[model samples]
Target: MPDILAVLNGVSPAWFLIVAGLLAWGAPWSPVRKALMLIGPCFALLAWFATHETGVYGVIDLGPFQLETFRFDSLSRIWVLVFILIAFINGVYALHERNRMTDGAALIYAGAAVGAVLSGDLLTLFFFWELTALASAPLIFAAGAPMAHRAGLRYLAIQVLSGVLLLAGAAVWASQTGSWGCDAIGVDSAAGVMLLLAFGVKAGFPLLHMWLPDAYPKATGVGSVVLSAFTTKLAVYALARGFAGEGALIAIGLVMAVFPIVFALVSNDLRQTLAYALINQLGFMVVGVGLGNELALNGAAANAFVGVIYMALMFMTLGAVLHRTGTVKATELGGLFKSMPVTGVCAIIGALSVAGVPLFSGFVAKTLILSGAHYAHNDLAYAILVYASAGVMELSVLKVVYCAFFGEARHHQVREAPQTMLLGMALAAFLCVYLGVDYRALYELLPFGIDDYEPYKLNNVFGQVQLLLGGAFVFALAVGFKLFPLKSDHTILDADWFYRRLGDGAARWGKAMGELLVHAINTALTAGVARLRARLFNLFNPAGALSREFPSGLMALWTAIMLAAVLLVSYFSPMS
Candidate 1:
């Protein structure tokens, strides 16, 4: 019964979280278990604030290598802090549930992410990077459905591949430079390319994003909520850390922004729609990282901070609906406001926040990115981003609200979410509005800053409001005319079609080709053996020259003559 915390080092708080996760299995008493679950992040935050300066906190030497476990800097400070906050919020939201596997995995996954952002070196980062994958896939499988199992396998494969690439990149980088520090790397190098892809896969970069939408919806309700919070944001932090200032990310970011809107618009499942919505938000951050100025980087950081909170709120609301109604299908959901009135209102706030309405967190955060794009005179990005903003409002906010909560009462018998869920959603919703109005709180915490950039600019607010209103008007028109994509159980194809559909076809074709090649080789060998047998028969059989009896008799006479000729030739040749 001695103090358990005495054993913890002051290196990084992630270790405490990891240990707490391990101990969750033995936590039998309900109150003690809940206390243990909440204490990890509380201690982590205490540890975070205890460090007064930005420097490497823990260093270890192993053979010829140095592992820097904790590095607090301007870049990592905000990310680590936000991760800790999200962990605490997720813990609170999950307190009512008693699934050990999901709870343990969530803690470990969060710890791994915490470790990753705080890692001072690529080696340390890679260790936690892989751990994030190992720890989180269980959350998906915890859903206990066949589809969840399959999606989990796919998720594991892709995530492990990312880890492999990370390890390779780290090794190559370390070999070439004699350093394993995590810093900005240009994609021109082999190490950089591998690392970019590794981060890209996690960040939901266009074609690499299907695993997220595919797997997240299949996870258990709470599992989906927790999964949505951590993994992708960790990747975004990596990009901000390592690939900032890489121009290619600008184009990559736009694609990330605009493409997912299409899928989200067409998606039938509320969770799936949110999955795509998450990608769309990541797109903005990716662009900010690509822009790489103080304003842009700040925008990216701020966007990430706000995005995590608002997105989690959205997921929480939807999770509540799923928990109560047993479905999140837009086709099946309607007039949920009748029963789950508080949940619906909270969800609407989350939607408005995500849509970047004035007086919401997303408005303040997303405006920074748009301002960066405009200031840089990257008109292409600027335009795409503006369009995407409107589109985001259309799909994520308007569409989600209409299909899930509004319209006639299809589901009339469900109750509002439990008090714990409502409490979690309320806390997050409060922040969404709080951060928006008093933007300085978040703006001051940005990794970097701009003196002149303002989220509350008259022109910025006016522009965003007009764009959203116009889009809403158009959406209303579209709905009136049945122009919007109708909801159905069917899903539209994306890059995953290559692997999901064409990949299977290619596999079948390759198998057939392999069979044909083996058969052809066997046929040729058999034919050659037969041909050889025929040739041998022709040469040595009774009809052949060596087996002819007349040849022997004639040969004897010829041999005598030949022997005489040989003897004469030998004598004449001077060797008798």
Candidate 2:
């Protein structure tokens, strides 16, 4: 095969989206919509393949800033290709959803993600970053429930704040450094810190993570699947691009790895549980980024690529459950294997992938990250990651699988997921297994080479199996003794308490103070008006002295007395 340079040298992948968006707009509920949804990715993929070399495609000089819209380097290629692949898979999954709002949002959201990854400058990245936020928020609100509305608002606030921070950081960095390139920016300067924070918010770092679980579970089924595919992964890609070697990320990653397990253990909603589990998995990638070596960076990239697939798989499976049974709560969902076998099997595959079982994509990808930690002699991070890996099995694999599919029947029978959803799940499932068995393809696409790392070695497989099976056995015992957390509808208090509770309290206090201020102003105005009215009545009434015949003489005497008093005061004044 000839290299991409020999065939089509300078092509812009973003323009293909215009065709897709136009096609989607032409028909609201026609067969053309489905065709556009599927074919759009194909056009993008063709564009992506046509460019084999790394070069800037769309460059515009804006006097003070040079905006490079398309940067086809190794780092961007890995991320953008997976994003396009995800868009196609998501399109397939959402094919059954005829809601034009969701369909349009998904396409726009996908385009924004592609635009962000391919951007070569901070200004361009900021533009696409905000577009992703603005485009994806509607997916959550499309559910049209009260909770969805509230969650969408919260999601919008956090995402927009991230964009604002990005713009601010970009301006500062450009002003200080006179460069707009999106390169590694360690948090040594104010601009770097601001950029780090901007990336941190979207990457769902420890304190900033509440929005993911809070909003994702509340979105419509198809909406949830679309939401799962893009935002956080894009953040991960940003981190890989900007802050890969910062030692601070190791501790951040460790905390990120372990912190969400508690919430996942106690979560009653399967979607919420999976959302927390997604955080746990992100921890590993963050750790990899912290390690800063080629192997570790490759590992982070590979994990992010595979993570998008598996997490979307899990969300898609449960989303199908929610669609068919009207609920995804563990208490309300059980023995679903008897009815929705296809979904159940797909969920199991997703579970295995997330739990990092051998021969699944998670195993291959997560190994590189952990191995990097171990090789770096960061024993603390290694230990935490190992423990967190087991915890992942407990919450995501055992709890999710048993609670939703393997237990006694608790509801009326329901049919299997639609053919379209199954088709989507099958594509993800094939990738999960294929990437595991043939991981070289994944590694080859990594930002770095993988010759030094071997995931399928006997020793690696043995250790992974030992930890995973041991965790499984312990989880089984815990379940037998009824030691696992019971189901409840109450929302768990998290870092969100800072916002949800304290913020709400502050808002209420401010509102009360505002009301009191308004009341005080009204009272003062009312009293002043009353006094003015009394004086007016006294002076203007028909009984006043001015109405009498001697009014002129009395008025002259009063004026003379006022003039004498003023003169007396002026005589006593020191300046006068």
Candidate 1 residue-wise lDDT, 1-576, digit = tens: 123343333559788688887777567665665666789888887777776577887887887888888988888888888888887887887778778787778888888999999998999999999999999999999888898999899899889999999999989988888899998887988989999999999999989998988889888888887788888999999999899989999999999999888888888888988999999999999999999887888999998999989889989988888888888888888888878889889888888899999999999999889888987899999999988986554566677777778865684589889888888888889989999998988988887765556678787789788888888888888878888886567877877788778987999999999999977865654463556555655766765654433323344556787999998988789643
- Model 2: per-residue lDDT, tens digit, 311-382? 889889988898899888888888989998998899899889988888999999999888888889989988
Which 10-residue window in model 1 sums to the lowest lDDT?
1-10
Highest-TM-score candidate: 2
Q: Which residue segments of model 1 deviate by more than 4 Å? A: 1-10, 26-31, 508-576
Q: TM-score of the candidate numbered 1? A: 0.87
Model 2, CA-based lDDT: 0.85
TM-score of each: 0.87, 0.89
